[model samples]
Target: MTEVELTMSQRLRCLVIGIPQATFPEGLLRPDEAASIPYAQLAEHLPLPDTLELVVAPLFCDDFDALEIIETLGSAGYRRVLRIVAPKLPNRQIVLRELRSHAVRQGITLEMVEEG
Candidate 1:
């Protein structure tokens, strides 16, 4: 994925991303609308804690790589991260467990999005 610096003035600098065939709804801050990303290319643009927030569309649902992303973010000193996922995904539990484990390994806590 191609990444650029976003200068939004917020405590949390979030990056919103959508997977292939997954639609990113309105209200997302897209730094580059014309860039396409490969699953493995995200390493280059991993968000730093100094930025405050990052949003990304995962290539695979509930995969280890996704957990790695969270771990990476956590290692960067990010205290919080919001992972937006499809409500209808089949592997939600797997992802959740993996995230939990990753959190445990990293000595940080993970929070899930609240449902209305």
Candidate 2:
């Protein structure tokens, strides 16, 4: 019998959004409607990666939450590039800088890919 080859699915890339839930209107929004809102907000946070396998969805609670995720991955010996998909937030730059610095400190050659 001939052997068959199996391949794993492509790893999903993260898509972090910066919009907070507080910005949502007071009226009720359907699930689809809420999803569309974040896509529109992406324009404000341009320069995102052209292709994304997976999206972080909605928005990060705060910078700390984002950083913690990255740090945890780093500590786990995940050396591949880590993508942080987030919208344009006030502390976006600061967060990126800190992440880069943390990667350096970890000595893991962890590159951060951003997709807003």
Candidate 3:
């Protein structure tokens, strides 16, 4: 008898963060494109991707959790590109300012994707 080895294939990882109530843009992600996980579970889900996409809600500006998310992802070696999808909001400017600053310090390339 011969022994055979098996391995699991890895899929491209993309992180979408924001309030569940917020609407996600159509065609942002394919039905079978990527695995969806809550922001809270990001850390536990290891082997971070070189590219990451973040969909943030304006409401997140009220807290520091959003910053933490970016920092965490950067520290984990997600340095290729950090795509942010944010819609117009009362605090959109403020939130984006902070996120951009953090991303620069972390050496992560930032790409702001305007909401359609």
Tens-place lDDT per residue, model 3, 1-116, is 00110011133334455444444456875433344445655556555543334424222433335467668766777666566666666776777787789888887766665566
TM-score of each: 0.48, 0.38, 0.57
Which ranges in model 1 have alpha carbons more than 4 Å from their true place? 5-12, 17-39, 46-49, 54-64, 84-95, 107-116
lDDT of 2 by residue, 47-81 (tens): 33323222333224533454554554445444545
Winner by TM-score: 3
TM-score of 1: 0.48
Our tally of clashes for model 1 stands at: 4
Model 2 spans with C-alpha error above 4 angstroms: 1-59, 62-64, 108-116
> Model 1, range 5-96, lDDT digits (tens) per residue?
32222333555433545344466644333233444544555443355444554523543355665666567566655454434457767767
Which ranges of candidate 3 are over 4 A from the true structure? 1-9, 18-32, 50-64, 90-94, 113-116
The whole-model lDDT of each prediction reads 0.49, 0.41, 0.53
lDDT of 2 at 75: 58
What are the clashing pairs of model 2? 15-56, 16-85, 16-86, 18-87
